[model samples]
Structure formats: structure tokens, C-alpha cells
Target: MDRFEVLSVFFGHKTAASVVAAHSHPYWQLEIVTHGGLRCAFAGDGFALEAGDMLLVPPECEHGFVYDKPGVSWITIRFERAEDGESRWGGVIRGRPFTDRLVSSFKIAIPGSADKPYEKAFVGGFLDALLHYIRSDEFRQPADSPGALLGQITDMVLARGGRAVTVSELAEELSYTRSHLSKKFRAIAGESLKAYIDRLRVQKAEELLKYREDSISEIAADLGFGDLFSFSRFVKKHTGASPRELKGK
Candidate 1:
């Protein structure tokens, strides 16, 4: 499997007026705005982004940035092109909750760890997933709509990094009725709120399970299941696959 072979990651915030001289390199660059805004010109096209916005710069595509606004924060991830990864992703890339959370996960990808290989694969997988979503209009739900609201819920779930969050808690946090959330979620996402979460849970569960570093019980707890039995049943019901099976065991 191709790994990201991450080169460097920089987390910085700036308020002073600054200009990043236009330049290009032989590797790839992924830049995300976590707060404030940035203006950049990429390949003759100018773009500006605020929090949750991002862009991927391909190898040797000249680009530069100007930070004029205060409280501008960003995460810059630069990596070598994988030996067996997608072609490339360039220009201004829109952001999503899941994407934001995954990018945030990079904060935990410490160097010289036993799980370095897994981390590389995780980074590569994130890029692949992002590329897939960015290519499709289907993933672009209407802004400030029900789909957008669901995005907030997704942000909460992923940010917890696998902790179980009850639907009731989500409803209360978002201050929406369960019926309304379910109704709107289904209308925009074409799936019930319960189903959407189940699917997301399964996807997260599988990712962790594949690593085999955490015990099934631990994984279950992270996914918010009370017990291994419940987690197994849910997995089987939704995917017709046991946790062990999904774990590639």
C-alpha cells in the first residue's frame, strides 16, 4: 500500500502583514485554514479562504500566500507523492467536517512512533478520501441547509476521535429536535439521522479496527458501544460483517 511519507507539518498563526514568496517544489502541499483568512494566487487564479477551507498544491505548481488579516491560523502539511497514490490534487479545495477532523488528526501523528507506518497509511488514506470527495458534486451538500447542520454533527463526532456520542446529546448540543434533525437529515442526505450516524460509526470503527492496536472492547468503547457484543451486532447488522471480519482478521 502507498504511504504518504509525510515530509513536514507546520502549525502557525500570524497577524502581521506577510507575503510568502511565490515558489514551487517537487512534492505536494496541503494547506488548511483553521482560523481567520488567507489570500493566495494559485496557477494564475486567485483565491481566498477562511476557517475550514483548504487547498492542495501539486508538485511544481507555483503558488504563494498573503496573510493580511489578524488571527490567521493554518496547518500546512507537505509530503512526497506516494509511490502508488492518486495522480494529484491542486488548486483551492473546499472543506468538509470529516475532512477537517481528519486533517486535525495529523496533530497526533507524532514522529518516531511505533505506529508510524499506520500513520503514513492513515495520511495517505485521508488524501485518497479527500480526493474522492472533492471530485464529486454529490458530496457538496447545500450550505446553511440541513446537510450543513448534519456537517456540524459530523464535526463533533469526528473531533471526539471515536468517543461515543448519543443522538440525544447531539440533538441537545445543536438545539434541534430529534424529529426535525432526522427529517432534515434524511431529506438532504437521503438517509435517516440514525442510519447516517450508524454508517459513520461503522466507517470509523473499521478504520480503528484495521490497525489492530486497540482491543475490540476498547474500540467498542471509543465508538460509544456499551459492550463488544453490541458493537459486533451493530457491525453485522449494518455491514453483514463482524468486527473481527472488518478488522481484516
Candidate 2:
């Protein structure tokens, strides 16, 4: 079957810390925060990133985090290809995944709610501006080369399904030391790589149980689990349900 993708960008704020379980994107996730902090778990590791930060997470990269304090606002842009060649995280683009690079913040300050007409218009314009900003080289230097590198990495991760990928391996592929890449990845993507991947696996397992014809054991193996017991345990831990029970309902 062909993968699906979506593209979107929006800003959000929070008042307290919230923990999100590991899960994958149906599309790509790019987030830039203007206020507050975020503590995220990706690919089995956790990181804390604050304002003046962004994150680039490919599809199916397990990740989750807590929104620290309140008055936290951020903008996220998701992109994906329309056809079979591109796959994405839901409401985010993951197709043609890329490495994280510093990009200038495109802040569109608008005051209103999503229900307000002016707010809608402002958001629309904001998105348009954001797309243009990324397309421009204000964020990436050396022309398009660096920017292209970011995109290439994302695309590769999404294309391969981003499962069981290690930090060392990712660093090696990008010709960076693990720590260097980790720092850069967090700066651009808004979360650690490991956290994202872990979220991906759990999220995929949920979908498989909910919507697919595959059995629990089958789903487990497909997700690279060593055994059904482990997969079952994971499912129970996350959703408070056994695979069979989730499907049975």
C-alpha cells in the first residue's frame, strides 16, 4: 500500500506540563517555539528544548514530550509529497525527510482564536509567509546546500520507516559525532531523535491494533519486536489494554 502525507503549520501555547507517549507521525513535524519550554522523549532518550528552538521529526519517529509551565507558544510546519513517493506524519510532512538545520524564525503575530475570521486569515497568511521563508535562504547558508542536507535526511528517515535506528548510526550517516548531531537535531526539530522514534513505534502499534487486519503477534514482528510477549507488554503499558482486547473492542 502507498503511504499518505499532509502539510500544515500552526502555533500553540500551554499552561502546564503534559507528557505525551511515544508515537509516530502520520506526517512530518516541524515545530518552532517562541515562548516556554518542552521536554521530549525520542528514540529512547529525553531532551529539554526551550524557546528560540525548532524540531524536525520524520514520520514514524517515535517521540513525545511535556509542555512546561504556561504561556508557551510555537509554530509547526508539516510537509509531504502528494503521491506514492512521499509518506508523512498526520498533519505533518515526513516525505523526503531532512536533517535539522537552523532556520530563521518566521513569526506571524496575530491575536485571536481559530474560530475568529481574522484569526483564520492571519494564520493563512502566516502559513504562506512561512513556506516562502523556508523556500528562501535566510535560514540556510551556502545557498541551498545546507538546507538541502536537512531535507535529505528527513526524506531518508521517512522513506526507510525510521525503526530501530540508533543515534550512532544516524550520526555516522550524516558524518557527525552523535553529540553534535543530537544538538543540531534538537535545535531544529524541537525534540531529541530517540524520543521521536519511540513514539513512532508505539503509535504504529496502536494503529495496527485499531485499524489493520494483522494479529497482535504479526504486528509485533512487523514492528521488529523480538517476541509477542514484549509487544503485548508494551501495548498494555501504553494503552492499558492487551492487543487482543484492543482489537476485540
State TM-scores per candidate.
Answer: 0.59, 0.38
Candidate 1: global Cα-lDDT?
A: 0.76
Judge candidate 1 at residue 126 and give its lDDT: 70
List model 1 lDDT by residue over 139-199, tens digit each: 5665566656766877777666666667777888888887776677778778777776777
Worst 10 residues of 1 by lDDT: 106-115
Model 1 Cα RMSD, 1 decimal: 6.3
Q: How close is candidate 2 to the true structure, as a TM-score?
A: 0.38
The alpha-carbon lDDT assigned to residue 198 of candidate 2 equals 59
Candidate 2 lDDT tens digits, 1-249: 222233455567787667677787766566666677777776667766676655657667787767866777766656543344433222221112221222232342433234455544544544445444445444344423545555545544554452456778778987899999788777767878776555666677777788889777777887778998988887787678898988887
Identify the candidate with maximal TM-score.
1
Model 1 lDDT at residue 13? 88
